[model samples]
Target: MAAAKDAIKNRERLLASVILVSLICGWVAGLFKHHSDIAGFLKQALPGAVRFDSSEDNIYTGLTHAQSESKKAGFVAVRSAHGYAGPVTVAVGLDANGKIVNAVIVRHTELPAFFRRVTDNGFPGRFKGKDCSDQFEIGGDVDSVTGATVSLAALAEAVRVACSDIATGRLGLLPIVKNKPAIQFGLPEILLILLIVTGFAAYGKKLPANTYMKWVVLAASLVFIGFVLKRPISLININSLLVGYWPRWQNNVYWYLLLAVLLLPVILRGKTPYCSNICPFGATQEILIKLGGSRRQLPEKCSQFFKVLQRSLAWIAVMCALVFRNPAIITYEVSATFFTIIGQNWQFVLLALVLILSLFIARPWCNCLCPVRAVSDYVRLLRRGFTR
Candidate 1:
């Protein structure tokens, strides 16, 4: 018992040391790369002939530029707003008349595919003619993207704030438009909350664990969360939190509820209800397992080694995200493929292989490579450590 305890302690210490070093190194690397990236982005986004002078204010850091040819002056403000995965830094250009000239995404940690969607759909173009006088509310005046609503909303809000800063601070104009209400509760949020509550009731043994009940939950997850919402919790979600990129609570009720449902049970009872009961990919794998009606167990040593590999991959994913400030770079999970049905060829192949393997092995992906499970295990370890 004493030897085993010593081994556990040694392993925990090693893990903690590795994580600390990785985070410190990642932060340093990110710092060096981030400034150059921002400078390049600002140059590209702004007009070529104008020289930009940094604003004197510390709070609203911006650039004041005067056109060499026309002598027209404008301001470029860099503002950040909360996106679905993280904060999006946008550069907003305002002419001296308070009219928006251009809005460009300077830097963001949003998912690459979603970012592409936002760009392709001309989300930034909508703000080109708007001024501080226009209300920047989505659905009120500014239209939001269908799939990338949160990201679009965030970008719009960022531009609005930047324009407001220039209008009031630089132009000496009084604020004309009232800020839009932040909170928005819709069908998606309601359904997600209900789904989480049902998962808790089912997993907590408050509801009967009948076959029908399981099937109902599985179907709901597959259809609503997977196909319709396309909002399955992923490694990127955890990475966003680790990097201190919290979703705006007022505008992102769905995100908040999902996190609460996934985390609270794990912290309190060591129960990963999200993975075991609520994950759409897990449901799909379970369905495959049932159809295959075959099971295989690896040797204890092999299982232990795979578990270590799983946790290591999780660590690598988080570190990569931290270092690069891009969640898409480290997103290896097949959940997006299953939920969105639109991803790279490599992702498709990976999802196919995992589903095929799930026929013989129960949750092969979850056991070997699921980053979410690894995160849940870490939370469980924390819970156990605190209790001890």
Candidate 2:
């Protein structure tokens, strides 16, 4: 009892230490390194409202880029709400007469391409000096960002707030930064910390084997799986349907849409549906241990050879998808001919037989073969605040 208590106390201390260090590092990295003369100008332009990121030195590059056209269209915005990932502070340009000018994306808080819905093909440029009447309207005149409407709404709000500041003489904007990471604020850092912290929370400590908790976790897991695997009605799964192209590339919207509607209702009906009750992949190893009143430790030959190879392949699949940007490779094997060939290959069938035996020995597919769940595990770790 005392050892367990001591361990818990140690965990608490470790959590605190990790959080503190992360915050300090993120704050220092976010500020005080890169200089922003335009940020200084924007600071002067709108004190206590928004400013340039002190990290990357690119505030004024926006103004310089727009200088040639400022006389033609002119832009004026003290702040921008339509951010890349989250809300951001941006220097909106307008014509001399207070009309909106070029919408220079001053800075954003998300990774480079996550918000491709907003940033792709210069989507933000469309808003340059857009009339106040134009907001979230659906049409080619205003293209829809695939999976990120929330970002757009927030961005619009940010811009409105900044404009209000200026209109009411509560703010002004004359100065700006030089280049890159156009805006800086505390919220983004704090949010990043919380996100990392959530990762540990999602990791979850080993809990007592209470039946109730087991049911809850199982149900929660199933519900999560159902939602993610649901076919594409929106942008979240657009990648599934897209094969890629140029000049008005297209998506196989109908194929995925049909699968979603048909498969969802049917899957919800079965005792375990596609995932296997208790998660075949989840419960395989446990079942194997108690198979038909006969159990034995896996032979070293089987464990050492297959287990290591499976883990290595899984890692390669995940890294290729994550680092090399190959979702097609990441999500599934993705070849009709490959699927056909899988059954015919003798080695593959033998592997399947071993997996089935593993169902008696352990969760064979989940431990070694499944790729989606592996990625989910990583996201779950981050969500639970377990990086510490």
Candidate 3:
């Protein structure tokens, strides 16, 4: 019976793990799944037009045309730049006398509303008469939009690149960069789904996996990386995405869905998949555990200090998290301001040390702290005496 119980427990953990992984993965997939739709919606909401050419009777064309009057009047390229998130390509048409003609967003990797900074309110029109030596930095000759400085910088960079090309007479040779797409339901997604399904089949009815959920998890993860990672890849960015764009119209739909998936593993599977498999942020923290595996020395006196600090921090964060109705703060505990701003260099080292030492101490971070796990643990309590 003891052996059977252990097997059962293991199965629960597997299911729980799959659930946590699926939630995170699915979130990302939704983004990629609807990326084009999102872009199109934005375009319809706010519009910008692109102009081609130095002046009247002349134009730079997307596709080369045959026997066209404008095609024959290709003029010298004098591009403009603005800083942007990644890179932005803008085509600025100048008159024969280097007078500004028109500007348009040719190509860029910035988010929606972000591109507007390039062609907003005659902003691009401002470049018409200025020589190449005019100042265009933010708050200078050109104004930077709020909440889009990086994207602005990237656009500026591209403009600079175009100008360099013009100087080298390579404007005609500018190569366009387009986004590449991933398979909608590729083999990886299929395999992951199969693995999840097998777990559910073996344990769904009797143990946690009685209802196979592994496949669902596998699918979510693939989508997360493909879609979510593209726009909200970084820790801060993802956290922001969850908060800023979490579907909140009808009774906080996105937040509730995330809560259900994140907490499901512990309740049904008896596993900590959130920490074990799905969380990229947690994965980064675990590096410290691996690094300090061999040479970890315990300080008996200071042990209580770390515990107190961790616990106090957790409660404070939990309270704030509870009030804000945001779960990101819980994740932030493991990666607080110290690690985020001041102690960044040491983050990798500390995470490695803690993760490796956990092999001996049974998840020191999860036990002493880890806001997300704490939430899961809290949610699990409500489900006591139940088996699902």
Best by TM-score: 1
lDDT of 3 by residue, 1-388 (tens): 9999878767756754654454455445534432122232222211231223233422232212333443322223323332212224465543333333444455443434434544564444555555433434556655775545555654544443443344234233334332223323444344444433443343333336432344334334434522233211222223334433332223223333334435566677665444444443443334445554642434666655765555456445434333343333333333332222212345556666655556665456655655555445544743542454
True-vs-predicted CA distance for residue 146, candidate 2, Å: 1.1
Q: Compose the digit string of candidate 2's lDDT tens values, residues 306-379.
A: 55555455445433333322223333321111122222244356455654566455544544445433333333
lDDT of 1 at 11: 88
Q: Which 10 consecutive residues of model 2 have the lowest summed lDDT? A: 242-251
TM-score of each: 0.84, 0.36, 0.33
> Which candidate comes out best when scored by lDDT?
1
Higher-lDDT candidate of 1 and 2: 1
Q: Candidate 1: where are CA atoms >4 Å away?
A: 1-34, 37-49, 56-72, 122-126, 136-146, 172-180, 209-211, 297-302
Error at 47, model 2, angstroms? 23
User: What is the C-alpha lDDT profile of model 1 across 172-284, one tens digit per residue?
Assistant: 99976766465868998988887777776777667776556666777798789999989888888777776667866777788878777788888988886788778888888
- After superposition, the stretches of candidate 3 with alpha carbons farther than 4 Å from their true spots are 1-244, 247-261, 267-312, 318-343, 385-388
Report residue 289 deviation for candidate 1 (angstroms): 1.6
